[model samples]
Target: MAQQKVKRLPDADVEAIFGAFAAAEPEPKGELDYVNPFTLLVAVVLSAQATDAGVNKATKLLFQLADTPKKMVALGPAEIEDKIKTIGLFRNKAKNVFALSQQLIERFDSKVPESREALETLPGVGRKTANVVLNIAFKQPTIAVDTHLFRVANRTGLAPGDNPLKVEQGLLKIVPDQYLLHAHHWLILHGRYICKARKPDCWRCIISEWCRFEPKTPAPKGS
Candidate 1:
C-alpha cells in the first residue's frame, strides 16, 4: 500500500492549535530535572535514547553528587557510569559526561555555553541536545525535534518532514512568534500524553479539530 500524504496545517489552523495549547498550558516546562544550567546540560546528554522519568530517577543522586562541572569531573567516569548504569548506553554516556565536564571546566570556565555551536562542541551534545539546552537553559526559541515532537508535528500536520532536522526547520518557520518559546514543551507534552505513537488519545486531544490525521482514534469504549 502507498503511504498517505501528510497535509500541512494552514496558518490559521496552526495559530488556533497553538492558541489552544497555550490556553491549556500557559507555561509548559520540560520534564527533565536539573538544579541549574550545567545540570540541565548534563541531564539532556544523559537523556539520549532514555526516558525523562528514567533520567530523572538516575540523576536524583547523581545530580546531588555532581551538579557542577567541577563536581562531575571530580566524580570521574567510573562513578558516573555506576550511577547511570540503569540507563541505556550508560558506558558511552558516562565517558561523554566526564569528557564534557572536563571540557566545560577547561574551556568554558565551568559554565554551560548558551550558543549552539559552543554547546555542540561538548561531548555527546548534538543539534537536538543543543537545541534543548538553548531553549530551556537560555530561554531561546528553539525546537528540539525529539521522537515525541517529531511524531506529533508530523501526525498533526504542524510540521511534517522525513527527518528531525527538516521537521525542526519546518516548525521554526511556521510556529507563531508569540508561541515559539513554549511550543516545544506543548508539542512534547501533547505527544507524550495524548498523541502517542502506538495509539493517540485523539478524543482527548485539545487540538484534534485542527489535526490533519485521518480516522482519529476514539476514546476506549466506556471511559
Candidate 2:
C-alpha cells in the first residue's frame, strides 16, 4: 500500500483559511442536541464512537425522562440503559451516566462543575468531553479534537500533530482569540460535511484554494 501524504499549513495561512470558512458559515454549533451542561456532558459521553444523529435519537427520549442530575439519578441505571439500549456501549454508558449523576448530586449540588479537572472527575467525562462542555456550555475557548477535527487539522495543515491533545494545544496557540469560541464548531462542521473521512468533497470545499493537499477533488463536469 502507498503512504498517504498529509497536507501542511502555516499558522497565518491556516488562520486566514479558517477565517474565510467562518465568514461564509458564520455561527456554527454542535450538532448534538442538548438543553444544558448536564445534558451536553451526557450527550458527549454517549457520542463516543457513535454518530451525532444516533446520539441525538437516543437523547431526545432520554432527556425527556431525565434532563438534570437530580432527575437522571431518579431515573436510575437500569432505566437509563433501557432508554439508550439502541446506542453502542449502553451498559457501560448507563453505568457511567448513573455514577456521574450520583457524583454530581453528592459533590457539586447536582450541578455540572465549571472547571476542567472537576468536570473530568465524573465517571464518563474525559478530556474531550470536558473540552466540549467547557466550550459549548461555559463559552470557554477550547477545541475538542475528535476524529473529524483530527483528520481535518492534519489534512488541511491547520494544526497538525500526532495526537488529539497536541493538535488541540496547537490550535489554541495559533487560532485567533476572537475566533476561539466558535472555531471548534466550524472545523467539525467543515470536516463532517466537506472534508469527510471517506471521500472529501474537495470540489465544493471553500478552503480548497488554501489546502496543501495535492490533486483536490475536481469540480463536477459541466458545472
Candidate 3:
C-alpha cells in the first residue's frame, strides 16, 4: 500500500494553528542561554550539532568569562576548546568562534551585524545561523530552519520543502505577519517537544487539529 500523502493546510487552518500557538504561549523563547547578541551568536554557532542543554552547560561558565567579542578573542581557540570540549566538534567550533569574534571586532566594531548577508560573512555563520541572529538578536521576522523546524514543517504540511531555505521561504509567505516574528521559536519548540521525529505526541499538541499529519499518534494505552 502507498503511504498517505501529506497535504498543505489551507490559509485559514494555518492562521488557526498559529493562533492556538500564540494563545498557548504568547511569548515563546529559544532554549539556548545567552547574555547578549554576541553570546547568542556564539551559542548558535556552537549548537550546530549539539543540544541546547549541552551548549548551556558549557556556555554557563564560558559566557561569564568571555561574553564579548574582545573577551572571546582574548580567550583564543585552544582555551575556548577547553571550555566547550564536551560538545561535538568542539575544536572547530572554538576556532570559528574565535575567528568570527575577530572579524566582528575588525569589521563591525564588535557589534553583531543586523543584516543576514553581513552575519553570514562571518566564519561558521550559515543561512540558518544568520536567520536566527537576525530574528532573535535584531528582531527581524526571519525563520531559521533547524532540524526540529524542518521536521515539523514537513510533517505538519505547514511548509513542506526538500530543503530548509525552501521551507523557510514558504513559511514566510504563509505565516501571518503578526506571528512571523516568533514563528521560528514556536515551530521549533513544538517540533522539539510534541511533534517529535519518532513519534509525535499529538494527543496533547495544541495545534494538532490544524496539523495535516496523517494518523496522528494516539495517547499511550491507559494513559
Candidate 4:
C-alpha cells in the first residue's frame, strides 16, 4: 500500500488560523472538572481513549469519594474500577490510578508534582497527560496533543505533521507567547467542536480564510 503524502502549511497562514481561533474562543478550558491538581491528573488518566463527558460523569461521583491521592489510594484498585467501569480500559486504568495515587502520597508528599519528569514517572501519566496537568494544574505553558488535535492540525493545515510530537513542536515554535498560556485549551476546543475529524464546518469556521486545507468541506445545505 502506498503511503499518503503529508501536507505542509505556510507559517503565516498557520498563525492566522490560530489567531482567528483564539479570537473566536478567547477563553477556552478543558471539559474535565476537578477540585485540585491531583484529581485533575487522575481524571486525565481515566480520560484516555474516553470522552470527557463520560469521565466527568464517573468522576463526579468518584472524586467526591476520593479526591485526594491518599484518599484515592485508600479507596483501592477494585473500588476505583467499580467507579470508573464505564470508561474504556477501566481495568488497567483503575490499577494505574491506584498505583499512581500511592506513588504521589509516598514520593511527592501527597502533592501533584510540578515538573514534567516527575509527573510522567507516575503509573498512568504520559507526556500528554503530564502536559495537561502541568498546564491546567500548574499554570505552565504546555501543549498536549490528543487525537482531536492531531487531526485538526493536519486537516486545518495549522501545524501539519506526521505525528503528535511533530505537531506539538510546530505549535511550540509558532504559537504566540501571549497566547501560550491558553493555546492548548483553544486548540482542543476548536478540534473538538469546529475542525472535526470526519467533516469540518468550514463555512462557519472563523479561521477558514487562514486554513491551507485544499477543497475545504462545504457548509451543510440549507443550514
Candidate 5:
C-alpha cells in the first residue's frame, strides 16, 4: 500500500506544539530508572522489545546485584540471565548486558562512555540506546526515535520519516533549541500515552490543535 503523504507542520506550529508540551510537562523524564549512566545504559538495552515497567521489574534486583560494570561482570551471564528472565530474549539480553559490562571495564575503564560512538561499541547498545543514554544520562540534546517517539514524530508531522534514523535527523534539525533537551522524553510520552499505535487519544492530547494527523481519534463511548 502506498504511504500517505505526511503534511509538514509549519515552524510556527511546531513551536506552539512544543510550547504546549513544555507547559504540560516542565520536567519530562524517561520511564526507565537507573542509578547512573551504566545502569541507564543497561536499562535501555533491556527495554528493547519490552516495556519500561517490565525492564524496571527485572532491573530492580539486577541493579542491586550489580550497578557497576565490574560488579555486573562479576555477576556472570548466567546470573544475569536469571535476573532478567522475565524480559523477552532474556538469554541474548543477558549475554549483551554482561559483554557490554566487560567492555566498559576493559575499554572505558569501567565508566560508561559519554559519546554515542563509544556507547554504540558496547554489545546490544545501538543508535537508539546510545541516543537515550546521551540525552538522559549526559544531557545531550539527542533524540532517540523509539517506537513511541517515532509514531509521535511522524503522526504529528513534527518530523516525518520512514525509519528511525531519518526521523531522528528530522527532529534534530527542526526542534527548537530551548525545547530540544526534553523533546525526546515529551514525544515518547505523547506517543505512548496519547498517540498510541492502535488508536491515538486525540481528544485529550495537549498538542492536538497543532498535530497534523487527520480525523483525530474521538473520545470513547464513556467519558
Candidate 6:
C-alpha cells in the first residue's frame, strides 16, 4: 500500500490555529504533577512510555517522600522501584531516577540544570524529556513531541514530519512566538481529548475549519 503524503499548513493557518488554541487555553500546563524543578525533572524522566495520570499516581507519594536530589538519593533505587512498580519498565526507571539524583548532587550541585545539554546528560533523559523540563520547569519555548503531539501535528497539517525531532523543529519554525511557550501542552491536550488517533473529534475542534485532514469524522448519529 502506498503511503499518503501529508499536507503542511501554511504560516497564516498555523498562526490562526495556534491563536485559537491560545484563546481557548490561555495558561496551559503539563498534566504531570511536580512540586519544583527537581521533582518536575524526575516526573518527566519517569513519564517515558507512561501516561501522565499513571506517572502522577506513582509520583504523588514518591515526590512527597523525596522531591529533591538529596532526598531522592536518600530514598535510593530500591524504594523508588517499590513506589513506581505499577508503571511500565519500573526497574529501569528506578535505576535512572537514582542515578540521576546522584549525578545532580555530584555535578550540578543538587540543582536541575536549565540547559538541554546538561539535562540530557542525566540517566534516561532524552531530547523529549529535556524539552519537557525546559518548557514546563524553566519556561522555555521548547516543544516535546510525544505520540499525541506527533499525531496532531501530522493530522492537522500543523507541522508534518516523519519523526518527533523533525516535527519539533517544524513547530519551532512555524508556531507564532507568543504561542510557542504553551504550544506543547495545548497540542498534547488537544490530541489526547479531541484529535484522537482512532477517531478525531473533528466536529468539536475549534481549528477544524483550518485543518487539512479530509473526511473529518462527523458527530455520532442522533444528536
lDDT of each: 0.93, 0.87, 0.93, 0.85, 0.91, 0.92
> Any runs in candidate 6 off by more than 4 Å, and if so which?
1-4
In the order shown, the candidates' Cα RMSDs to the true structure are 1.5, 1.8, 1.8, 2.1, 1.4, 1.5
- Provide the TM-score for each candidate, comma-separated: 0.97, 0.94, 0.97, 0.94, 0.97, 0.97
- Model 5, stretches more than 4 Å misplaced? 1-4
lDDT of 5 by residue, 82-123 (tens): 999999999999999999998988999999999988888889
Q: What digit string (tens of lDDT, one per residue) describes model 2 on residues 11-94? A: 678778878967897788899999988999999999988888999999999999899999999998999999988899889999
Q: In model 6, what are the clashing residue pairs, if there are any? A: none
Clashes of 1: 0
- Clashing pairs for model 3 are none
What's the distance in Å from true for residue 77, model 6?
1.0
Of 4 and 5, the candidate ahead on lDDT is 5
Residues forming the 10-long window of minimal summed lDDT in candidate 1:
1-10
Which lDDT tens digits does candidate 3 get at residues 91-209? 99999999999999999999999999999999999999999989998899999999899888888888988889999999999999999999999999998999888888999999888
TM-score, model 2 to reference = 0.94
- lDDT (10s digit) by residue, model 1, range 68-157: 999999999999999999999999999999999999999999999989999999999999999999999899999999888989988889
The global Cα lDDT (0 to 1) of model 1 is 0.93
Worst 10 residues of 4 by lDDT: 1-10
